[model samples]
Target: MKIACLQFNPKLGEIEKNQNFASGLLESYKPGDIDILVLPEMAFTGYMFKSKEHIKPYLEDAETGITIRWAKAQAIRLRSFVMVGYPQIVKGNPDIYYNSICFIGRDGELIETYSKHFLYTTDESWANEGPEFKAINVDSLGKVGFGICMDLNRYQFKAPFDVYEFADFHLQQRTKIVLCSMAWLSNNDNYNDNDNNHEISTINYWCNRLSPLILNNNNDIGNILVVVCNRTGIEDSTTFAGSSSILSISPSTGSVHLLGSLGKRQESIMIIDVPIDDDT
Candidate 1:
């Protein structure tokens, strides 16, 4: 299957602009050529919207909202499934919002939705942390796990890490692809105007340190493939260095392959062909 990862800098609180940008990317692909397209966390409304009230009008229902409807149409038109993140208001609890990743199947069906299990400190003020750790299944791709930005960092936590570890073990027992959506930030010094020779070294260190964890786990139970899409640009004094990529793990030898950086703070789509095997 060919999976595309979209790495881009979204204009903060600009939903229509972001959606238009996404549509342009989708238009470039031929029908049935791409199987899945993964987008970053809060792709619709960029991270760090100043007010919840301001951001509220842009929130969409994962199943039937205009965003999903447009995505569904694109999925059906392109014959590809889409996994994109957006802020959603939970039904019956209007006051509380959730950071959600919605899965739209190739036929435009609402397959499943996964709310972020781990919310960053900044997100805690506006969104509720998801209580469930569930995996979604795609027919050609096998069972897939969905996680947001901070959820990756949660692997360092004991209890949540245990759960994630087990989830990895179980997915390896069935599938090969694990999908992640992120709104990640590099160290502030890396992007500062006054250049420091050590800043480049610092950025590389942080990227190398965190990148591999997305591909192979410490437990070594599964040889999984990771497709991560992250946002770029600065928000509220925090700058996201968009180095989103696809990390592939060889099931037979556990070898790892890193493909595409998509450049910092720019929008682009990366396509990778993932091979599935009997052992994988």
Candidate 2:
């Protein structure tokens, strides 16, 4: 299967502009060229809203939101599975909202939806915590686990570092693929100026966070795949750590391989074609 990550800087509160920018970036790929396309958390709507009232206008209907419309269009246009993050208002309840992600099948239909189970600082300001970790079965991809930016971190970043809630869930479920959309904050603000060090650091940190699955590699684990699609550029005072990547962990050798990755300042898609070995 071929998977692609679209990484770009989205202006705050400018949803239409961001959507056009994303569409233009994906114009070159012909339909059916990409098997799966993933975007960063809050891919178009910028993160960092100050409060619920601050993001009120941008909250979308869980079933008919603009983000879902865009994702569905892209899914149909590319003939690929599309996953993106957006802020959602629970149906019939404008008072409740969640930072969520939705999956669109190749037919432009909603396949599944997952709200962020772990809220980051920014999210806590305007969104409610979601239910729990989950894995959905997509006929084409086997069991696929989902996670947003903060989900990979320790619960509220206060739990034992070794707990690995997200990775552990996927391991227990024997998930074949893991999809993560992130607006992960950058530790170094100057990373865009040809400073490759910080980008490497971020990638390493992510790999380590998911090391549980790598270390527990068994025949059942075969070749577990992970797609981390992150955005770039600074949003107000916050800068995102870009270096979106695709990786594979081989159970037989207990090894992790980097399939492809984007740099800190790139505004493009990182695509990789992975061959599945069913027999392990």
Candidate 3:
């Protein structure tokens, strides 16, 4: 199966612009050539939504909403599964919202919706935290795990870590791909007077450090493909350094291969062919 990750800068609160951007990227790919297309978290609206009242109108319902309808149409047209992130209001409390990733199948079906299991400290003011880690089965792709930005940090905990515990529990279920949708920000505060370090070291310190560690640990347990889709550019005071990538792991040896990366904070679609092991 082939996969594509879109890395681009999103305009804050500009739904039309961001949707158009995603549409254009989707149009560039050939139908059936790519099995899955992953997009970054809150791609429609920038990371900081200010408040529920401010973003209420932009929240989408996965079943019959315009965004999902458009995405499903695109998925059907491209014959590829699409994983997109957006803000969604909870049914009971209409006022409360959840950071969600919606999956659209190649057949124009709304496959699954995974709410972000871990909420960022900054997001607690507006978004409700998700309680469980959900995995979906995508026929040709085996079972796939979905996670948002802060959910990756769940691994930082020592005992009974949310992500690690989730991974341990799910390992027996035979998942193939672990997909993450993120709006990764570069740490500009740490760039003061570190002239002694190499340029690569400085870059890696802020941008690329956590990814390899996450991929390495995941690869060791099961041969899973780790794909991260991140947005670029600056929103409010935060600057995003786009480094979206795909890493493939060998089940037997746990060796990782760098499939691809989009190094700039510009619009890009990265495609890579992923071979499925029949033995699994």
Separate clash counts for every candidate: 0, 0, 0
* Model 3, global lDDT: 0.71
Off by over 4 Å in 1: 155-175, 188-222, 251-254, 278-280
Residue-wise C-alpha lDDT for candidate 2, range 111-217, written one tens digit per residue: 98899999999899999998998898888789988999999998998998888988888888998899999998887776454643327788888888888888884
List the global CA lDDT of all models: 0.70, 0.88, 0.71
- Residue 174 miss distance in model 2 (angstroms): 0.7
lDDT of 3 by residue, 5-117 (tens): 98877898888888898888777667877888899998887787777777777887767766677778889888989888988876667866888988998898988988887
Candidate with the larger lDDT of 2 and 3: 2
Q: How should the candidates be ordered by TM-score, best one leading?
A: 2, 3, 1
How well is each residue in 1-280 modelled by candidate 1, as lDDT tens digits?
7888887777877778888988887676889678888889988788886556767887776677766777788889989988888888876678878888888888889898888887786677678778866676668777777778877654435463234543344344454567778887766525643321222332343334334434454444455666777777677778886767776655445355665456665667888776665323
Comparing 1 and 3 on lDDT, the stronger one: 3
Q: How much is 181 displaced in model 3, in angstroms?
A: 0.7
Worst 10 residues of 2 by lDDT: 190-199
Clashing pairs in 3: none
Clashing pairs in 1: none
Stronger candidate by TM-score (1 vs 3): 3
